[model samples]
Target: MPELSGPRSGSEVPLELLRTPPPKERADAARNRAAVLEAAARLFAEHGVEAVSLDAVAAAAGVGKGTLFRRFGDKAGLAVALLDNRESVLQEAILYGPAPLGPDAAPTERLTAFTDAYLDFLLPHLALVRVSETASPGARYRIGAYRFWHRHVAILLASAPDPDVAAHTFLAALAAEHVAAVLPELGEQRLRAGLHQLGAALA
Candidate 1:
């Protein structure tokens, strides 16, 4: 549950590790955005993400349906917006915080830390992430967040026979859809342990 308070002094980070903030909003627009996300969060929690609709979110937020669609595009986009803050925290940790989740750890340790930290965020947000990732064919791979994770894992697996392929394989197991499908059977402890073993083998 630990997170980076701020970037470490003198630490340089890759461009991919940087997340671009969304365009600034006007005061009224910002209020609308906040209301939309807040309403969506409540509805998703109350009824599950899959059961909620953009129309419902707009109604709950007191925004026009057209406004919601224009701002977020779709339910998947809304889900992505909702996770932005939590994802940024993890991103900052990987980009500049302390070992083993940050800069300076040995690859094996960093890899393990990454899985553990990722799961910490992911498990609680599984349904939201599953919607964002599985919204379309190859939607997960298309995400900038996925590219950042894949790059980190691929670099850590550089000594492996096929780092690129292995990284994809490694992340495949961690995908929200895949993890959600198996979690009920394997449970969190076994899943974490198995991922640790996989990380060791890949590293």
Candidate 2:
């Protein structure tokens, strides 16, 4: 179990774990990586994430399939690489920035703020986010970044009965696949509004 404690708890996973710096790479390796990400992004945007493949990305990047596989492992890993910077920024805000997302607000308010910010993040990148999340069965649960989000929300819900379960339930409502399915019907505004009801029932 993740240590449920204050922000600076020694047992807590380090924020550095989430905001990892890119590994140093030789110029050729770095170029290939940049080229791969650029090509993948363009292809994903144009054809939709589900419609594209790692092979397509590799061909677009002019890198060999072997290189793409070695560098990113798969399409999911490539999506994750593309999202790293934005995820790091969001993590930084939640940990150190300001009220609501930061530690300064009341728990309910913070959770609501998280929902709002996260919806904004999820909307534009829905396709890619879904790809990263649904790469494999239970892939979302296994992601390191998912753990960070879970821990943060679980901490905020610390006063509840089974904050762990509450956190998981709340996050279930925001899963990329679920959101994608509901979005066209609910649309962004109603969708976000519905999600804002995190329910004092949990409290």
Candidate 3:
């Protein structure tokens, strides 16, 4: 798999996949992926995610439709690629940053921090997140990112009455649609407060 480098931070994080060398790609193939991502981001920003299609993305990127299809299986795949960098950053923070989010923090504090950080990430990338989730009803739960988060939360909740249930329930509260649906009416402040309350209950 071709890997893209994400922004680095001072703290060292154990991201073995990211740290390891990826299989090399032909120069042209690399260029094409970059082109497609850039074009898709521009088009999505200007026309909105719902208005853009894979065909349009191919045209804008000046790549063949077949190339686009091979590069990204669908719009959801493209959205995942677009969000990869941001996701990596958050992952780094959780794994290696200071207290509250990193390993040094207490379980409750870590859980609270994760919820807040995840919500912060969700707001700006709501469109892409929604696209990924809507690709299939259970798609979000199956993604690699979701698995990582679930594991992290489960570990944090290890001492809880039921770690597995607590972790899943926590993640359910942060699902993209669940948050997006209430965002307009509740606003970020209220929404975050609600999530904090939920986290507190879990803790």
Candidate 4:
């Protein structure tokens, strides 16, 4: 029976005793958190990251502005959380999705799968994807995926005429997206074709 009024309402209550909830949450906290994240994602997607403020997120989520800051620390932290949420989906597809993309395929096949998987997964996320690419200490959302592709290609390159040369070449080729940003003419189909040719050459 926690009182709904001023500090004196629970003044007689012991600190630890009042801190404990019957079930740790009154149900509203969990709902509010979910609503907040969902609203953040939607708003961030609709409006660019910089355009969406904490107050807007709170209004969209139906929570107080204080709650948003408390949960996410700050705007950058909120952005990172959104990126993490997106990466989790991509991780599941690559690590546990269909054949070739997952672990069951042959090395060469997985290499191709890696290229295709990234193209498919990353294309839709291009909007939010660019945000993490800029230099930031905690901006590591893409590192795991990039490392996985590099590791897979490096393994396949090990048996090549010059493994070192092949691995570096493969790495350089896979970095086409960075170039794609500069070259607007390179569409998705051409990008995939280019990656396939590069993979074939490295393999």
Per-candidate local distance difference test: 0.85, 0.81, 0.78, 0.60
lDDT tens digits, residues 82-112, model 1? Answer: 9888888888888778898987778899999
Q: What is the C-alpha lDDT profile of model 3 across 44-86, one tens digit per residue?
A: 9999999999999999999999999887899998998888778
Query: Candidate 4 — which residues are off by over 4 angstroms?
Result: 1-30, 64-66, 73-76, 135-138, 141-180
Estimated TM-score per prediction? 0.90, 0.88, 0.86, 0.62
- By lDDT, is 3 or 4 better? 3
Most accurate candidate by TM-score: 1
Q: Rank the candidates by lDDT, best first.
A: 1, 2, 3, 4
Which sequence of candidate numbers ranks them by TM-score, best first? 1, 2, 3, 4
Q: Cα miss at 54, model 1 (Å)?
A: 1.2
Predicted candidate 4 versus true structure: per-residue lDDT over 1-203, tens digit per residue: 21112121112332122221222445787788779879988998798766888899999999999988887767655655565655555555545567676556675786787777666656665555555544364343344444434444555555677654565576655443464474367777787888788878777
Instruction: Give the 10-residue window scoring lowest on summed lDDT in candidate 2.
Output: 1-10
Residue 159 in model 4: lDDT: 60
